[model samples]
Target: MLVNQIDTRQGTNSTPEFSHGNTLPYTGIPFGMNYFIPQTTFDNTSWSFSPMSHQFAGIKITHQPSPWIGDFSDFIVSAITGDIDLKADVTNQMGSYRPDAATFNPHYLSIYDQRYETKTQVAPTTYGALLKYTFDEINPKIIIHIPKNGSFILNENKNEIKLLIKNYDSHFNDDFKSYASLKFSNKFISTLITHQDNPKYDSMILSFNNIDELLIRLATSFISYDQAHFALKRLTNLNFESAKKTAQETWQYYLDLISVSDYNTIKMSTFYHCLYRTFLFPQRCFELDSNNNPIHYDLYNDKVKKGYLYMNNGFWDTSKTVYPLFAILIPKEYHQMLLGFYNSYLESGYLPKWLAPDERGMMPGTLIDAVIADAAIKGILTKSEIRNFLKAMLKSANQESHDTRLGRMGMKDFNNYGYLPSDKYSESVNQTLDYAYSDFCISQVAKLLYEDKIAQKYSHSALNYQNLFDPKTGLMRPKDSSGNFKSDFNAIRWGTDYTEGSSWQNSFSVYHDINGLKKLYQNPNFIQTLLKLSNQKPAFKVGGYGFQIHEMTEMVAIDFGQIAISNQPSFHLPYLFEYTDHPEYTELLIKQLVNQFDDTMNGFPGDEDNGSMSAWFIFSCLGFYPVCPGSDEYVFGIPIFNKATIHLPNGKQFNIKTNRNCPQNQFVQKRMLNDQPLKSRSLKYVQIINGGNLDTELCLLPYSKENIELPFSLSN
Candidate 1:
């Protein structure tokens, strides 16, 4: 099964200094409310579960999206065979575990502790999980650690324990709490709840005298303890094996959406693992109530609201590729997500940019505009819903929020100066470019709703990116309030005006008007500029960030020249070659870039950033990518697989076939859609969803031709 084929630790071999995908070995159902990971250390940091670690801390119930964002409502469960002193220091209680023998699948997790001589297995449900422990010695005990302010109640008669904890990073109410209920199969011979002035040391220990085996059914809720109990009912009649099988089936249903036929087992494994990463984000923050209606804890109002809500996603990253994939393969789920985003807008008064349970307001522009616009163009949202979302988009574009993290950073200045001034805001170049693209997306939605005046306004604002374009450098330079480019402009400098990249990586971010950007350059001719970007040495300077950040280190480590595929800003760099006459360059670059990924511990070049990189691989493997989401077109690349099929939600199959697809055949010689010659280096959204065969012929030699039809550009 594809689920079993995935090593959840594919990207766990990473440190803060560098990232090999910087991902946790998360074991849970797709978009489950809670994810379980075998914690290896006592440090409550983001690097909790490293594949290289030998110490077995416990199984952590985490709601953490990224280590950068931190975790919320998190705790640990561990089993010990002998009596151990109850203390706050988890490092002392940690036991040795063989990382090679541990199982880290998406549906299940199993680890053996040498000190305890116990085997612990976990099978996940949507909101809860079934944990089984086999003890080789007597006096088997279960430990539940609450790292912060929390309290627990034990019911000896019911063989259950209820826990409530108040632990979060930010954006939650003061009274915010996470509740959990644990039902044990064996009655406790003795119970001890440790309390200390330092809340980090508090824990609950339950000992069973003679049981050789024990089972723990755990359920968690953001609402109440009763709700947690209600969620636990899902595993009431099911055993560990049954729960594991059900979790596997749940993941298989999603994994079966795309099937690849390739003889290369290694590449096939890599592809499916990338596919697995795609469905692990924007998790359901809502819970099913008594009547099976969805309700969520609204942090904005500090009350439970009746609607669908999702969290742990940054739209600035996912909007590029993740939602586009969803639009093509799973429009139903995409539609529901759109509704959830709209609900967030209704509650928070602006569309979310980064939502980890609530508005993080990270990144530069309100790029969720692209997600909404893509859905609007694809007809995934209703007319009224589109209208409502358009209002939310425009509000963020015009009005500044009281909390800077809730909406666009420099809204008033952007409106006044046509671009964010470098002196006024950090990463102003990225902020300006992102705003322009967002404006273009706003225009798309406005046009769909027949709001011609609003469409014209945003469409005009979309060209504001031209204001910061430096004709001499052929790069997007940062400008001040007086409309002068920054004097000390260095193309290789990272993160002064750009968002995690330098001018070489962030300059060509003109997704809406690539043709226009090209026209701005005459001597280098934009195509030559892209060549310079790819051919130049991977050099960088500590620009705005006085120190070399991890992103800079990763970019240099990958050695992909100035094209830092490790970050999102450079995601569409290779595809930009398609806008030029030399389309074969894109094919060559994509083939080279994809080789960096595999189905191992070091699966990605850098932080996957909530499936953005994974979706990029998925799209490139299928021989196309969504360069401009709101533009309704996918720029062509070279397919990596011999054959693949996408099962669309509309019961149609979009098949992609590549002739002579191997390491030798790196360039596209010819392309056909539904047996007709595809002259343009792009595919329309309708053509994909309607579903037909997309065939391509690959050869080692580069194919060169003039007057090649380019992708969608505003100037065209």
Candidate 2:
């Protein structure tokens, strides 16, 4: 099965000095609440699980979507033999393990601790994990380190351990809490829960004797200990192999959705791993009850609510490709996730921008509007529910929440000045452009719901990006409150008014109105501007970032000019060439990017950021991309493989075949969808979901841009 082929550590080999892709070696089911990973190092704070590290701290139960967001509700479990050292904490009590020799996969993990002479194997379930420890020595022991500020109690009669964790790094207003129940096969010879003078670092250590082998079953919950026990009972019967098989089967069910047949094994493997990453986020936080009803703990209300809830997703990273990819392969889950997002809105009174457990309000704009509109436009949601979705979209667009972190940062400023002022917010230019795109999304949803008046208003408001576009530089420059462009403009300077990117990367982000943006500098100049962006050196001036940020480092690491395909801001850049006279340049750039990724420790170009980068790879390899979500059209690109067969949700298959498909023959010559020629370099969303064959002729020579229909634009 394809699931067995995935390494899960494809992009996690990173360090403070250099980062390839800051991904975790997560072993779990798709969208599982808890991911099991070997904590390679306890050094450098949040940068714990490094693929290159030789030391094994323990196996961690992590809900960390990204290192930037940090992990919460996380705990470490380690097995040891011989004499016990009570004074040794997690940092001091580490063992050396060969990272190269360790077994790492999506379903199971096995690591040999050289110091303790113990071999540990871990298998994952949705809410819990099964751990088997085999020690070479007579005295076998286990240590469980709960996060600081968390409490745990061990029951001798029930042979169960219950834990509650309240420690989160940068959290929202919610009283973030996590519960867990751990069951062991052997009797606990001795157990101690101790508090140190530090108070911040406390642990529960359990010791077992005579037994060389022990089995540990664990379950986690966000609601209560009862919920945790409920989860533990559901999976208590599962053994290591059984649990691994179950998790593998769950992953195979999703991985089988898209099958690629290519002569290149490594490339195909990379594609499958990227495909795997796309499904591992926006985890279902709700658990099934005795009646099999989904229920989740609502943090806002401080109560357990009976419904579906999803967390650990940031819309800023996922809105571009992840949701669109789901709309294609897993529409049913997509619908449920949309419902889950709506549930988040119902609880928090606003749609979330970033969520670990609740609203983090990171990034810019309410981009969930884009996800909703994309779903609505694709007709994924039922007619009965479109109104509710539209209401949520409008609420985000119009109603300003009292907390700036909950809604748009500068909603009132955008409404009053038509754009956010540079002085008010850090990334005002990004906020303005993102808000404009989201407004367009809101308008699309409103249109779908037959709210014509609402649609028209948002449609006009969507053009707010025009206010920030400086005609002189032909870039979306930051502007002051008095309507003057920020005087000092350097396109390659990173951050101030832009979010994690320079003006060169952020300017052409008017995905909704590409043609309108092109008109600001005329078509020819627009083409020249795009050429300059691609042809220029990848050099950057730190600007607001006094030192080099990781983004700057990533861009410079690759020789892809100013097109930082490593980040989401530059994701649509390759597609932007279609708006110009050089459509083949877009194809060439995409091929360059698609080549950068492979099934290795350095698989991704940058931080996967909850599958955004993975989704980019999946879409690019499939030969089309959703450049603008909320719009039905998918912009065309060069396909990497010979053939790709997508399993659509309606029991149909959408097949893409490429002829003369080789490394050198990278450019497309002709394209046909369902045996009919497509004049445009794009496909409708309906065409893909309805299921059909798309055949393309590719050769060594680039296709001529002349007389070719361009990708969809607002002016078109």
User: Model 2, residue 353: displacement in angstroms?
Assistant: 0.3
TM-score for each prediction? 0.98, 0.97
Q: List runs of model 2 lying over 4 Å from the truth.
A: 169-174, 196-200
lDDT (Cα) of model 2 = 0.85
Provide the clash count, candidate 2. 0
Write the residue-wise lDDT of candidate 1 on 443-494 in tens digits. 9999999999999998999999999998777889999999999997789988
> For model 1, what is the error of residue 29's alpha carbon versus the real structure, in angstroms, after optimal superposition?
1.0
lDDT of 2 by residue, 88-191 (tens): 55577788899878888888899999999999999899889899999887677787776667787888663678888877754444467889999998887787
